[model samples]
Target: MLCRILFAVAISLQRVEAVDPLVDVSYTRYQGTSLLNGITQWLGIRYAASPVGALRFQAPQDPPSDSSIQLANEHGLLCLATGASPMDNTTSEDCLFLDVYAPTNATSKSKLPVYFFIQGGAFNANSNANYNGSGLIKASGMNIVVVNFNYRVGPYGFLASKEVLAGGSVNNGLKDQRKALEWMQKYISRFGGDPQHVTMGGDSAGAASIALHLTAYGGRDDGLFHATAAESQSFASMLNVEESQYQYNNLVIRTGCIDEEDTLACLRSLNVTFLQKNNFNTPSPGAQVAPIAMYNPVIDNDLIQDYTYRAFEQGKFLHLPAIFGDDTNEGTIFTPKNTSTIGQSDTFLQSQFPALTFEHLRTINSLYPVAEQYPNSGKFWRQVSNAYGEQRYICPGIFISNAHARDSVSCNWNYHWNVIDPVSAAAGYGVSHTVETSAIWGPENVNGGAPASYSTTNSATVPVAQAYWTSFIRSFNPNTHRLPGTPEWGAWTLDGYQRLLFQTNATAMETVPDDQKKRCAYLSSIGVAIKQ
Candidate 1:
């Protein structure tokens, strides 16, 4: 009779568990609350989407306090679609949620370091949900909390119009970032993260955004992050407002949504499919579907008060330890094979940029030695790389490194990822943009076959890379005796021009000649030297 009773109770419990619609999570400030199933784990707490309706276009309002209803567990709908990237397709406008991945065993007394990742996709592609922080969280060994939040992207996030400005909407994307950081400041401790020991980091456009945040408004809220890691993007390397506005206006015109008096509203009301279909194309010749042209954060007066490079040059980055670097062949990702054949002659070069004299073109070519090395490669590949490198990576990185070096309170370490995957040779490119991300997070989790391309030598390179990165995350210094092997990370100096070069054979130190470095620097300064 007792055995029979236990069996019946087991059946009842199984049925109840199957029918339970939500999961409950308890936070220090809030009591037990049910959340939408999958979303709860991602956030590690219950959170509701902002309820501010039309005020959604305005700065993000605080999440409502609800004691009764279970916050939905599934991921919030991503913001309205801006393009056809994988991130845009999976997300919805209700996507203003933050995921906190902390050490599962951590406690309130455990003050773990925090890594606040800003996702990249030119501010129009990608989302926080796309990143799985489990590897990074575990690799660091420290109680590391990974926070990923959705910020408005595309028109909703970066619309710059007279009406929107009049209505007080400027840099909505940046404002969203600020609010997310503020939320972390107020609540991260509850999840075992040390708000005081926060390290802000990101890749590609995300890295650019971090750079913007650092230089914006006297590095507002300097207390938020103790260190910054900008991967493959920098302020000096990004588009200024003038350049960005031209592309934005072209996109606005192409989308055919100009009929409405309120462009932001019209954009919001349109079906996600229609907006994406009309506006979807690889904007520049070699660019991805969403390149620097289609969508990006603008230098609006409020969020980005001045040119990001100028801010860095003026020593405005709150004197934080900084780690900044780029892939050796960042441009190859976008460069195609046919570009060189099509524009091999001086006639083609001059025709493309009629304003440029033969002398000017030669001067530009002399600076980018890779063009000479692969003269037959293509005009689009060679010339464009030189131009983009100047506008995006080379100049800005050197400038920021120089600035940080001069700012006594700041320590700067620079790297050039020279390790090229032999497998990627099938694609006829060297180490491309975003190749290092797999190493930083770990190899297996990287999407598709992307990580597989990183050769055996490349795979072996992971430990050193991981050690360097986690060391930075743990102490805000990439240099530590803890790193394996004998090579030591040295401070970059204007005189020595020393930078760490990560190659397949070995991780070693090299001193770049001031002249060669200056040539590379001049190439980056082509259009924006005065601006910096």
Candidate 2:
């Protein structure tokens, strides 16, 4: 009798294992895979109709209706990029998919907080594949859900001209991000994610994307996301659409559509391969050796009406709780080498922002004069790196943090990521841009192995970083669920300028130094000349 009861229990366990992890949204069923790590993931789920043929260059459209049970086992193709990318071979114009990861035992009624991330590649090359959520799911103790998706990039996404704007659209990439957010609001509950409690986060260009959304449509609160976390945010020049017409004209001429009645229609009608081949053939006049980003967000007077600096100055942004900061040396990677002379450094700056006059350059040089004690990659490399980093990444982060503290009723948290890596320090990229990403996402998910110390000598930093980030995602405040023995992270206030310093075994709250504050103030004073 005891042997028979054991056999019955074994059969019951087998039956439980046979059930498939599936979800239904808007009549479409998705068969997901249950990872061995206790997380259930639905990959390559379509969020919008394919933007091909007539839909090319237009805003994202609703996905077509389907009742079939589609397999969500592998990632979809990445969106076509403007230049060489890590994974360009697997790209297509039809890419508009998102991935979702949740606890295996979660039900529709679980209503766990959602963390939606956007990947960055200078608004050109990169995809959601770089960020796998399995580790983050485990880090959260299988309590929260994680999501990431792809969007259009390059000329296909940011092309701006009267003809293109009138006939098709502009900023389609930003629109693509919006479409994915709308999809989450509509269907995340099926994956046990609470749409109403979503936290949007990103790094580099991804962080810049979040800043645009915060000020999009004149700070319109669309009820899409509740809070934000950004690292190395950038606020590039916001030129008028007409200023970029030269690039649009060059593209149309190269594609043999300049003579056509409607250039946008002609370009869209061409085959994807022919267009992709021609996308990189034409280069703007005096385009730098390490070329400046030509295709950028424009002043459309609709989605993006003005510069991000001006928008924040006018208090025109969502007053949501936020965690924003930058690395100690953001410009190390962006500044070009072999700039042995001050002339070369000045040329580089001019190439980045053409609107800067001689006087503006002089002011920038005076503000960031070469320091005697600074390390050298070039004669004036450190000076140029400091200037470029402040103009692009560092100041922009401070701008957002100050704006949040001054305008928002909700608390704002900021950090300075200075955790040193032996490999990076040896390579001269001291706490470079996006260096802390692996820690936030868990070192295991990084494409190549993460820094050796992340898993060995400095292993303790990983859990601490994850705890603060996930804590913010789960609750609006980061202090609520932080790990034991960690320092209390204080909110950023206008008077204090307090921010947390995230370092290995030495994390603590610190104040922004007075000198850096003066530099940021000078940059803000010349916002219009730089077009930021």
Candidate 3:
């Protein structure tokens, strides 16, 4: 009787195993020809490689079929890494793939808002695959699809020559973005994502790219995203065609490719290793001598007709909900090697700010005390921080934010993240640029070791940050009262004069006094020309 009972149990277990396979996925053919694989159990999705090869440099072609393939257990390849930064690992010319994460058991009938992210790397470094959307998606209880794909970086992506321009192809990286948006519009429905409620967002150069997209003619027609959140960088600081050409010519000369008739083709034909060894290996400031000389998006008349700053000023941007801001220490990342601290004496300020009168320097120094702390460092960091705050980051942030506020009917939100912690302290940089990225995407999403301070705060603030992001994605306004552990986000106005300040333990909604903000603004008006 015992043996008979055991046999019955074994048979029941076998039947249960057969009913649910190890990899639980549902596949459907999409875009008429391409395989659209959805991992229903895992709640992930990706596209199979397109069959077209040489046509790759051209626009993205439609997938041949709408049929689904089994996607139960595969992660897509990351874009090829071209720079010497320790953060990058995988890369490829054929890395035009994206991934999406949605609620399990969700169908077309259950549409959830989507957050589309564009990764930042100065248009030449980093890949989208490094970021994982699982935590954000799960924590927020929102259907989120994170698209990570490769647009051409370096010579392969952004080469503009007389021949290429005549052929009508410049800013191929931007073109890749357009194609991705097109893909999202046609197929997000399959993954239970709302096609019409997409929020486009990015950081650093990615932020600049979004700003460019907001002003691009093709971007206007893409009809993919309804809202935008640009972080850290803006089009106001973007280099124009003349500026780009000057940099391009210098790079060509540096790389010994000036003699080539077709610079783009020649650069592409060279081994990636040879290019990296000769150009990218060295640590250099600015765009000069960067490994990916030909990789910058150009101001082609068709897509980008004029300077982005000019476009925003002239009200050429799309009338969409927008949120943009920068951190307090944007220039710390690019601080030059020879920079020194300012002395307490009036004589030192005069030398540094030769353009300013002695009285002006005294007034500035009085407001921003340089010699009070770190006397040995000579208040160099403080002065530099103040200068960069006004000229590079604050000026542009305010200008663009104000522009969007005036031009668009949709709401605008501005933030000043002053969450300086021990991690940045360890790095000898305070509230540096790119510090907030881990908070946005979560610690696991970043590549390098985060500061020790990051671990302490991640448990509480990570969820809060993700909520703020997801809420913004679901609704253009980030002012949801439902977010736990934070005050409501308010509309940023020129008159009320407040900025949302994000910290590790608290989120403060405070009005920045006109006097404090204006000092930086005044300093910016003069310092920009001096730095240029």
Task: Give lDDT per model, in order.
Answer: 0.60, 0.81, 0.57
Model 1 stretches astray by more than 4 angstroms: 1-56, 68-81, 85-89, 127-129, 235-264, 280-292, 341-362, 369-383, 453-455, 513-516, 527-532
lDDT of 3 by residue, 89-206 (tens): 4555555666565555455644566788877776665444446666566655534544544455554456455644543366776777777777777766666666776788888767
Model 2's C-alpha root-mean-square deviation from the true structure amounts to 7.5
Cα lDDT tens digits, model 2, 341-453, are 77888888777776667898888889888732334567677678888888888877887888877885446888999899988777666778887888998888877647877
Off by over 4 Å in 3: 1-77, 80-82, 85-89, 218-221, 235-237, 240-243, 246-263, 276-295, 341-379, 408-410, 447-449, 519-532
Q: Which of 1 and 3 is ahead in lDDT?
A: 1
lDDT at residue 453 of model 1 (Cα atoms): 45
**2 versus 3: better lDDT goes to:** 2
lDDT of 1: 0.60
RMSD of each: 10.5, 7.5, 10.8
Over all chains combined, what TM-score does candidate 1 have?
Answer: 0.79
lDDT of 1 by residue, 1-532 (tens): 3223322322231101111223223332332222332211344232434523466457777766655644433444555546554345466556666666655555455666778888766676553334656667656653366777667777667655555566646577777877788778777766666777777888876787878888777677647677788778743323345554545456557777677676656655666555556545234322323344344565666677776766776777666777778776665655454565423433333322233445656776665554533434564565555444443565567667777778764367877777877765445466676677777767764544345745355777766777777667666667551355647777787776678888765878777656657666664444343232
lDDT, candidate 2, at 20: 45
Question: Model 3 compared with the native: what TM-score?
Answer: 0.76
Best by TM-score: 2
